[model samples]
Target: MSEPKSLEGVFHLVHMIKRHMHEQIEQLDLNISPMHMRVLKIINKQQTCTAVDIAQLLNRDKAQVTRLLNELIKQTLIEKVPNPEDKRSQRLLVTSEGMEVLAHLTTIDGNMNNKMMKGISREELKEFERITGLMTENLARAD
Candidate 1:
């Protein structure tokens, strides 16, 4: 039997689009990578969270999360504070600089999403999200 064309095309398109978005961010002057920006976004939204929070949220390892936080701190885009309840734990927070970065990135993100949905109606967008959510659940269960 032949492979399903629609599935293969969707996979390739997702990969290509993600790669292009990364490339676009790479052209920016920021010292952070796309991964770091993702972390910053979570930190920004949460106000303060531990490295473990990021690790769990991103489905990444704690060591990797630590390294990313270290780099973000060095770049002055995020600040680390001692967790009030645990001296050994640290919480991450986005700096004013980080917010500025997020603001610009948010604009780009909105524009990209808008472009992707240009011809799709609101109902179509909702259906797309529902289908994607189901797909995500299926994949998670497969693991």
Candidate 2:
């Protein structure tokens, strides 16, 4: 294949994986996109993150992140509070409902991983992860 075609294949592979991940995640009735879940996961880890923080973590735009946060707040999956240091900004956190959804999604992820690794050895899986991480880092640097 041509170099451009090869790159397209890699991009499509990432897209397919993302689509499958979201499809499985939706089975848990989270009603959130992969992007939304990513934001939630980051906020959950940080405890209280701002839209700018989420946008930076997700490599998204600040305005789009703000819109996503607003939707999550309206859905009651996340709550917004005034930032102690920046009154103009809001801090984000997953609600109890969000936690419940995350718990289910985690279980689904565990099952999916098990299925994907049915025949792969632990060493192979580790190598795969290592290579993918390296490739991701390389691509990030190219940008």
Clashes of 1: 0
Considering every candidate listed, which one attains the maximal TM-score? 1
Candidate 2 structure quality by residue, lDDT tens digits, 34-54: 777777788889966888888
Give each prediction's root-mean-square deviation over alpha carbons: 2.3, 2.4
**How many clashes does each candidate structure show, in the order listed?**
0, 0
User: How much lDDT does each candidate structure score?
Assistant: 0.83, 0.83
What is the alpha-carbon lDDT for the whole of candidate 1? 0.83
What is residue 88's positional error in candidate 1, in angstroms?
Answer: 2.3
- Superposed by TM-score, candidate 2 places the C-alpha of residue 143 at a distance from the truth, in angstroms, of 4.6
Each prediction's TM-score against the native? 0.87, 0.83
User: Model 1: residues >4 Å from true position, as ranges?
Assistant: 1-6
TM-score of 2: 0.83
Instruction: State residue 7's C-alpha deviation in candidate 2, in Å.
Output: 3.9
Error of 1 at 75 (Å): 0.9
